[model samples]
Target: MPRALSTPPVIAPGSLGGSPQPVLPVTGGLLLRPWEEADVPAFLSAYQDDEIRRWHTRRPSTEGQVQEWFEAYRQDWKHEKGGHWAITCDDDAEVLGRIALRGLDFDDGMAGVAYWVLPAARGASVAARGLRSLTTWALAEIGFHRLELDHSTRNHASCRVATKSGYLLEGTKRSAAVHDDGRHDMHLHACIRGH
Candidate 1:
């Protein structure tokens, strides 16, 4: 029989800072920081990509919708629900992509990570680097026992990123979620702390 789980302490906003957001530095001068209003254009552009639209459900067609999306990120962080970071180079502020920890559950001591890189930023390991950085922070700094990531079984690029970021494939959920094309089987991957 499984033992009763210990209650994890509630994570309060500003415990880490005025905002519970983290700015992570990645390879090649790329830095992951909180998404800003200035990044809306780049965010919209990245989402216009076929791959992003294919895999993710939320697609904002207008600039206002994009702003709403950014606002949602702020709300999430302010409430200690989750964090979203824009992937950008240090020299320029243009967003290259995004990475986020969503669906935070303190009771379970777990969260889900997701990421996407602009087409121009692909093939340079930007997603992998960002994922690794976030995973490390989530486990060490945030005290999460497990970090989970999932992608369509057909998304080979995501598979590579998950493996390269040290997340082991756990199993597949058949028809777990619906995508643009239809229901997709998702491969669940996870990295547990102290493993």
Candidate 2:
């Protein structure tokens, strides 16, 4: 027997892909904006950072790869699969880091959060600020029910960011992420709407 449908989907299909991704403002004179063609150099430079490279192994290396990635990011916004942003100061446009909503599922009102700050931008709570701003847009401005943050267990900084941003620790997924050294456990954290 088929069950009758009672509740509607948390988010409607095309509701996200139909609209242009917005530029978000973070406290401390920070802004999260869409990637641009001119940001290629800074974007590639981030890959050279040991911390960024180790955690985010899947990254564009060359100009061609980054170009392809830029095109893909545009398409992802249109398709509602993901949203990417460059973290920069409101006054200075130099790319300070990267942050994104990956594997967005509109029907479930869920998405994964990921981010990294440049060496120069570290220890300023940049990641936490950007994450809080994005979470507000996702939960309050829009209508997402939940957002998940996962990072390698060895990444203590990320754990701090997640907690500071109000994402409660859910649990651990053992051997979930494969870093350059080896597989590492991942800590999962999440925030629900109105919490």
lDDT of the candidates, in the order given:
0.87, 0.91
TM-score of each: 0.91, 0.95
lDDT tens string, model 1, 1-195?
934556535453354435457788887888999988888888888778999988888788888999998888888887767899998888989788899999887766789999999988899999999988888888887788899999999999999999999999999999998997899999999999999
lDDT per residue for candidate 2 within 94-115, as digits (tens), equals: 8888899989976678999999
Give residue 79's lDDT in candidate 2 (0 to 100). Answer: 92
- Superposed on all Cα atoms, model 1 deviates from the true structure by an RMSD in Å of 3.6
How many pairs in model 1 have backbone atoms within 3 A of each other, for residues 3 or more apart or on separate chains, i.e. clashes?
0
Q: Pairs clashing in candidate 1?
A: none
Candidate 2 matches the true fold with a TM-score of 0.95
